[model samples]
Target: MDDQQFRQLLNRFGFSWSGYRKVRKGVKKRITKHMNALGCYNITTYLAELDKSDEVRKKCELLLTVSISRFFRDREFWKSLEKKYLPDLIDKNIEKINVWSAGCACGDEVYSFKIVWDCLRNSLGHLPKLEVIATDINPVYLEKACAGIYSSSSLKEVTEELQSTYFIKKKGKKRFEVNALLKKDVIWKTHHLLSDPPESKFDIIFLRNNVLTYYEDLLKKKAFRKILDSLAPYGFLIIGSHESLPFEPKDLIAIAPHSFVFRKEAE
Candidate 1:
């Protein structure tokens, strides 16, 4: 599909053209493959097919997904999580800590948090019981997440010591598998950001690089509000470093200027 055709598909689904612009080449390829699979000769035919079937539309959305992530993606942000925000969170919530990894692609972000938490625990003795909910709309990504294996490229930001501590290298393979220890207390679910959040209030919600990056303003605001509502008092909401909120939310205050970390102020 061409840029104009892709933009039409994105507009119909409330996705952002600017957000997908840089990565549209690969996404367009995926959509074109999907179109061919559906026996569509052109964008007009594909759009009609998408309108006629809910499943077709959903499949198209999946095809549009850009799953570009790596462990400790924003290294500075991860440092803040490890040295600053999380330490404060533990000080307040001495009993249990709940975290949500929204749009957790292939578990990289979720496992990154777990690694940080683990390192923190070892340094400061036992921490509060931790529970993490990692959600994404794509089941294929979740399956890869559950498997816990990753390519060397995905571990680029991961330091040697951290890598040794958290992952197991397979024989004759360049892939690394996340240690089983990090997998515990993590619940992987197929969830849409537009839907209601998981049952519990979260101490930390990683909404990075997804809703705010992909969706239009209306959908971004709607989903952002739901995410804000799910944050516990004084909880932190982390968005992609390059992303910004669709509108100013009175309840959230920016904690870090360089990174997109915001803290929920008490209501």
Candidate 2:
């Protein structure tokens, strides 16, 4: 598809072009693959087919929503959470913790959080009720996440200690499967950030790379507002290192220097 046609397709699905320019080549390649799979000889035919079939259009949307993810993606971010944030949160709410991994692709981030929690719990000599909710817009990703198996490349950031502790090497395969204990507490579901309101107050919400960086200003703000609404008093919000809030919401305070971590001010 040409630039205009691709942009039109994305626009129809409520995606903006803020960061589309940089990823245009990759997006076009994906579109071409989808078109070929659908037996369309040209962009014109594909567009016509896309207009007629909801299933095809949904597949196109999934293709455009890139699902690149890895465990402990920005290592420093997780370190900051372990050494700085979690301690304070634990002090305040020692009995329970609620964490939401927004845009959690294939379960890496969710499992990462559990690994950190396991270490912290061992050090503290107490176990709190940890409820982790991982959500993504794509059903295929959710399915993969539920399986809890990952390629070696996706586990690169995971330390040797963590890998040995939490994952078992798949027999005769170059992949790792998360241990049953780690997977037990996590709840995976399909969710859209823009339209769905928060189901419950969360102690910490990880709204990293994709949701904030990929969309336009208006949608970003809308999603941000919903995120803020979901955070409990004195709760934390984590975003991608390269991401910034579209507009600062009132009473949200940055917790560290040059960090995407912020805490909701208690009313």
Per-prediction TM-score:
0.98, 0.91
Stretches off by above 4 angstroms in model 1 are 257-259
Query: Per-residue CA lDDT of candidate 2, range 59-116, in tens?
Result: 8878888777899988988887887789889888657888999999888889889888
> Candidate 2 has which clashing residue pairs, if any?
none
Lowest summed lDDT across 10 adjacent residues in model 2 is found at 12-21
Q: Global lDDT of each model?
A: 0.92, 0.86
RMSD of 2: 2.0
How good is model 1 by TM-score? 0.98
Q: What is the C-alpha RMSD of each candidate to the true structure, in Å?
A: 1.0, 2.0
Best by lDDT: 1
Q: What value does the lDDT take at residue 134 in candidate 1?
A: 96
